[model samples]
Target: MQNIWSIFKRELRAYFDSPIAYVVITVFLLFTGWYFTTYFFLAGQADLRVILGIIPFAFLIITPAITMRLISEERKTGTMELLVTMPIHDSSIIVGKYLAAVALLIAMILPTLVYGITVAFLGDMDYGPAIGGYLGFLFIGAAYLAIGTLGSSLTENQVVAFIISLLIMAAFYLMDKILIFIPNSMVSIVEYLAIVYHFQNISRGVIDTRDLVYYLTLISLALFLATRAMAARRKR
Candidate 1:
């Protein structure tokens, strides 16, 4: 436990001291801020409906960038070799790095609270929906980050990692719509497989156990794959 925490701190500090964290956070906040303010002023949407709709698109762009260098850069510069030799457990290292990425995401999300604040003062606002939406957003981010981590583990090139992760996300996001033209019976199964389908239900201010389970399952499965990838590298 302590070992995981130690590694987590090291990786988290690396993100903060390095420039990527700042760049990702600033860009994310800027885009989200723009969307929120624009919706409030121009579109006359007092709710954060616009921002919620924009999150998936924003994450498709940023999540890959965040995970692109997670493992690839470490291997590229020989740091992965050093990291693998540490006294900590294998799971600790993977969890540590993964948590660091999650932390950065949560931090970026922190600033978007201003949108909720703004909405609160404008009209009758239901906090339940807002909180549910944020929960859904966080889970979706976690699941995508897990996929990105697995994608990064599969390659030592950041560009390849980014492309692979983004491609996977795009496929998941479009899975629902792509199933529309399929046989009606098949669409139901396909929609269940689609990430956005579950996400949409949770995002609409309703917390469904199935949606929560879906995101958790995706996160767990991807992390398991990433762990296997790390073990294979260590064996090699």
Candidate 2:
């Protein structure tokens, strides 16, 4: 546990030392802020419907972009050897890296608060939905980051990692949309596996245990796959 915490702190600090993290966060916040102002204030009578909804869509790219190099960069520069040589467990490294990526995602998300503040200032606002919406967004981001981490572990090339993770995320992100076109017989099964189906329920400010479980299960599955991939690579 101590070793995991040590690695976690190190990984978190490493993010601040890199320009990519800053650039990604800045760009994400900038574009999202523009959309928020445009959709909610400039057009939609102070309703945050579009802005709240677009948060997770934005994460489909940013999460993978942040984690595309977590393991690939380590392998490219030979840092994986040093990391493996340390006393930490493989799970520790995976958790630390995954947590760091999620933290950066949270930071990128923090600036979106300005949009909420702006809406509140403009009119009467119930902040509960806004708060829950952001919570749901964070959990969704964590799950995506975990998937990105697993994708990174599976390949040593950053571009491949990004593409793999983006595909995985896209499948999950669009699962509900795709379900609409499928036959009625398969709708139940498809909804069972749909990420956005569950995400939408949460976005409406009700934190269902089933939805929370879905994200938790996805994160656990990704971590398990990442651990297996690292173990297999170590045997070579």
Candidate 3:
């Protein structure tokens, strides 16, 4: 636990030490603010449905940027050897790095609170759906970050990592739309596998156990894959 915390601090500090965190956060806020403001003025609604609709696309770009250099840069600079030599499990290292990414995401999400607060003041707002939307974003973001971490683990080049992660995430994000080409029998299977379907379900304010399980399973699987990738590197 201590080792994980230390690694978390180190990785989190690394994000701030460079321009990566600032650039990602700034871009995220700018885009989200634009989308939210545009919808807020046009719709005159207090709901966050517009903003929620933008999140998947925002994450598709932002998450890859956040996780591009996580492990890839370590290996590129030859620090991965030193990291693996530490007296700790690879899972610890993966989780520590993954958590740092998640923390950065949380920071990005925090500033968006102003949007919700503004809506509350402008009109009658139902906090239930808003809260549920935030929860959905957090869970989905964690899964995406885990996937990005796995992508980073697969290569030592940051550009490759970013591209790999972006492709994977884009596929998942577009799963629902792509499922239209499949037969009816396969629609249910693909729908169940699509993250956006579950995200929408939870965003509607009804939290189903199946949706929770889907996200947790995806997150665990991605993180497990990342840990295994690191372990394989250690063995070689």
Number of the top-ranking candidate, with lDDT as the measure: 3
208: Cα error in model 1, Å: 1.6
Model 2 alpha-carbon miss at residue 136, Å = 0.9
* Cα TM-score of candidate 2: 0.95
Query: Candidate 1 — which pairs collide?
Result: none
Q: How well does candidate 3 score on lDDT at residue 41? A: 84
The lowest-lDDT stretch of 10 consecutive residues in candidate 1 is 123-132
Ranking by lDDT: 3, 1, 2
Let me know the TM-score candidate 3 reaches against the reference structure.
0.97
What's each prediction's clash count?
Answer: 0, 0, 0
lDDT, residue 230, candidate 1: 77
Model 3: worst 10 consecutive residues (lDDT sum)? 39-48
Please state every model's RMSD to the true fold in angstroms.
Answer: 1.3, 1.4, 1.1
Per-residue lDDT of 189 in model 1: 83
Candidate 3 C-alpha lDDT tens digits along 49-156? 788899877999999999999999998999988988889889999999999999999999999999999988987767888888999999889889999999999999
Candidate achieving higher lDDT, 1 or 3: 3
* lDDT-superior candidate, 1 or 2: 1
